[model samples]
Target: MPAPNAWVLTEGHAGMESQAVGLAEALGLTPEPRRLRARLPWDWLPGRLWPVPLMGVTTEQGPLAPPWPGVAISCGNVSAPVCAALRRRGVKAVHVQHPKMDPAAFDAVVAAVHDGITGPNVIVTRNALHRATPERLAAARAEWMPRFAHLPRPLVAVLVGGTNGRFRLDGEVGADVAERLAGMMERDKVGLYVTPSRRTGEDAKRALADRLVPLGAEIWDMQGENPYFGLLACADAIVVTCDSVSMMSEAVASSVPVFILDLPGKSRRIGEFIDMLVRDGRVRRFDGRLETWPVTPLDDTPAAAAEVKRRLGL
Candidate 1:
């Protein structure tokens, strides 16, 4: 028999939702994405009130609880209170990524080793888990290959991300990176598949299009229909900015070698994580070389799922 329904919650963020979906797939569980509602009066206090809307608004009718699933898996800070509510009703709660609060609140916490969170209930991984199955990769290749069929022989994938309050992804930086990549493309007659994240700045997107798109590259803004996975699957090599660990993790999951763009003043956690990966020979920094190295895949989703199942005896 199939596993019981799992409720997955995200605050409308693609990355968090993607991770929840990936974990559900890895665990062979059916996940139903549910919108969460806030239950606290403090949730409506001014600028702090963002969570009220992000987590659906509470009503005079009652506490708007969605259908209770056998399990609840959540990502990001917004899901904490919602997960707690589910737990109160004896629902199993599994949280992916550091809770940004206490780990003890969740039944199991799946965190990145670089997150510096260690606990009995915590499962640390080198990178975030993703669902990059061979079937998905094959499908992506089939869909994207024809678009770049006439561009060039070798293709380079540039995955762009924007600032996350702690960092800045400026147009000048994108131009600089694009220039360096364009130089490499010129020498190798390379094709380019560039995709920007939702956080990616408008100026950066424009800069990339103005500087790199005309050089036989296909640029995908948020409006573009192509899936980012297709770019990762079809590229000879990937160039990712140092802002997103999830993006880096997905790139490493691909068979191709990944090169991270330089971010001088980014978080120390990112630096430490990159250092560990480099020392372990999993990924390389962008230094004008396309080389492949064997990577020890550290997929935590299955392990986490197994542990959860074992705990629940399901």
Candidate 2:
């Protein structure tokens, strides 16, 4: 018998693509491996108004067939309509994150706890799903270890995220966080592996680099030579800014004690998630010092995949 064919739709964004790919891997499904193009005429519009295509568009040209997949999963706001369209055609659709419309429309909605959504079909998780396979981690360790071998032990991984919603991660904040991190590094005599996301502004990146350069720390931008998973796998401890849910989720998933850099006037969603982690003793807030805490690795992807399989009777 042939392996089950899954038509995975990864419109344009990297985060969406990652989630789709991760879900496909977890479900043991082989994706068609063809990119799907989505046309957004109103993407340039300001004030949060977006117009997206409802049907799946071929990466090259033309529209895809209705009921294109045994199952369809979407991660971002833009792909929700497409998934809904697939659901209308009897395709099993699972929506991840907060879709623009009513989530009840989807066959299954895997929402984070911070989204404040609860329902029978909705599986509320504390963090977004991520899969760090052993092969992937091994590759990261092999590739990144030798390059930084001469550096100090107990390396600190600083994962910087850009501004979103009410949380603004500006240059000033990066500078302040970097100052505190540098102090910790000085006391511990450990090297720093700094990685910045696309949302991280050029000014913030410059500020972090400026402060850490004088301290003899290594900095890696998203456009830099190293892949991000390598930094995450090889780091001793991770310090993540409170701006990104996905980043924090991946860090905690690594089974490392994650330290969150507190942001001023953070959004309630961010605050709620952080509070849950603290209450569970999964993470701690960095207060200008190196503190130790115990953490348990969370593997939500496997449970989510199993649930999806059971729902679809796969």
Candidate 3:
């Protein structure tokens, strides 16, 4: 018999994987996470070009084998073919992001509006899918409130991301972010809970810590347990670096006010995404100040999940 839960696959990229996992959770399905490791020539070719994609598939968790899942959700390009291979065997395939193939080939495609893909089966969203729903936030707040009691009131959550190939978020850039954040502390009397991603290099972390730490900001080294969920739930306001669309999306989903810290990047898609969110009054650009407004928590993940359930008849 097929499994009772959904199979969520990714290339182990945290941002991509989170989108798939969030959609599965929205659908009330337990997510079985799978990390794809494509071997040899298969890894070179695009997912659409693979003749027998399953032959190229292997996983660190285990080998891809029989007793297929009833549904599979994939996010990254490399993981799309695995979902497609499973789809041929009666699995309902749902891909997040542009599949780079015919949208009709999959049961459903959850694409970002910036991708510019539209089809009957495609569910386009203004914001990226994330797991910061009200239920999860409530649970997180209950679990994390006591842990964060030491931090001062009017807590500000800073979701820090670092340099990618396209963005220059180095030590100098990090220090610049710190200076902007320091303005908030000085002006609003706020306490900051900053969480840096692995992409934040040691030099960048040092630069950020040198300034932010002395200003009474507690930066998470990303060493022990992650306080991401807690910070999202408990913070009065949120500021995220522009390098990560995922961070921006998740931060906006919370009830708190969200601000995107501009970085030196030429990512057109990210720029478009930010523009749409700003136009919709969901977010604002950070300019050395903390501002609050009426917040309408984003419901894009549940919306995508509803489309998946409707079209797939699950």
Candidate 4:
């Protein structure tokens, strides 16, 4: 059972929530997730610079009142001040990702190596924290294996991400990606399962679905429970779009061979991260081939959690 003694703070963003929840679970804490929203001018300003942190936080669920937890795991710059405020009140606060401010404010700042931020209080990791535990994988495998039994062996999981500030995955690009993945499935006789993020625009998903689904690929249309964990558990190879560091981090953290699908536009920072993995032989670029290779997972969730424990003596 998870201990209910921690709070996972975010601005209600999926990526931020995942990282914060991942850390809290790693700490054996069943956290109360709170989304901090700042109204008016406060929302436009930097959370790190807030004079009164609590003043900026308001939750639709309830007011940001007291009875705070012993631990606060925060992600997202918007909600960072709330974590700092909790820390000042004697709660141990840990921030995931770069806080975009001084790292010394939190008990520990969990950052990625690519971010290039470092301090005594910083815990640098090769990948982002996620909620992909071994036990969860085992359970997913047990639950989903039967459902996917008819799909055949060598199942490939394709994670499709859409447009972001840096990259674009429009219909044309989506078709191109779909064509390549479909080629892999047809050529390799692999069962292809594709999942798209909310960022995956409808047109992009349609493009992918139109092409890949006809080739016996299973693409989740964002209905029912997200089969993401199931795909992770059952995949022999994982192909993920390069728009998100968090998504790539989760895939790269797995022992399965990972293939990075390229998108339009250049993101040099994320490119550097991909290059690091490529140099290490842990990942390769997707080019219509289902090539297999030995992969040793490079996970940092436990390490970050351990740092939290070490810092807070929890």
Candidate 1: which pairs clash? none
Q: Write the per-residue lDDT of candidate 1 for residues 121-206, one digit (tens) a residue.
A: 88787778677756687889999778767766567788888878556778887677778777777776777788889888888788
Which regions in candidate 2 have their CA more than 4 angstroms from the true location?
1-11, 31-67, 223-225
Q: Number of clashes in every candidate structure?
A: 0, 0, 0, 0
Model 2: lDDT to the true structure: 0.74
Task: Show the colliding residue pairs in model 3.
Answer: none
Candidate 4: segments with Cα more than 4 A from true spot: none
Q: How many backbone clashes does candidate 3 have?
A: 0
lDDT, residue 102, candidate 3: 83
Candidate 3 lDDT over residue span 71-129, tens digit each: 89998888887788889899999999999888887899999999889998899998889
lDDT of 2 by residue, 88-179 (tens): 78888887777767777787887788888877788777777665655677788899888778667787888888777778878888788778
lDDT of each: 0.74, 0.74, 0.87, 0.87
Q: Pick by TM-score: which candidate is best? A: 4
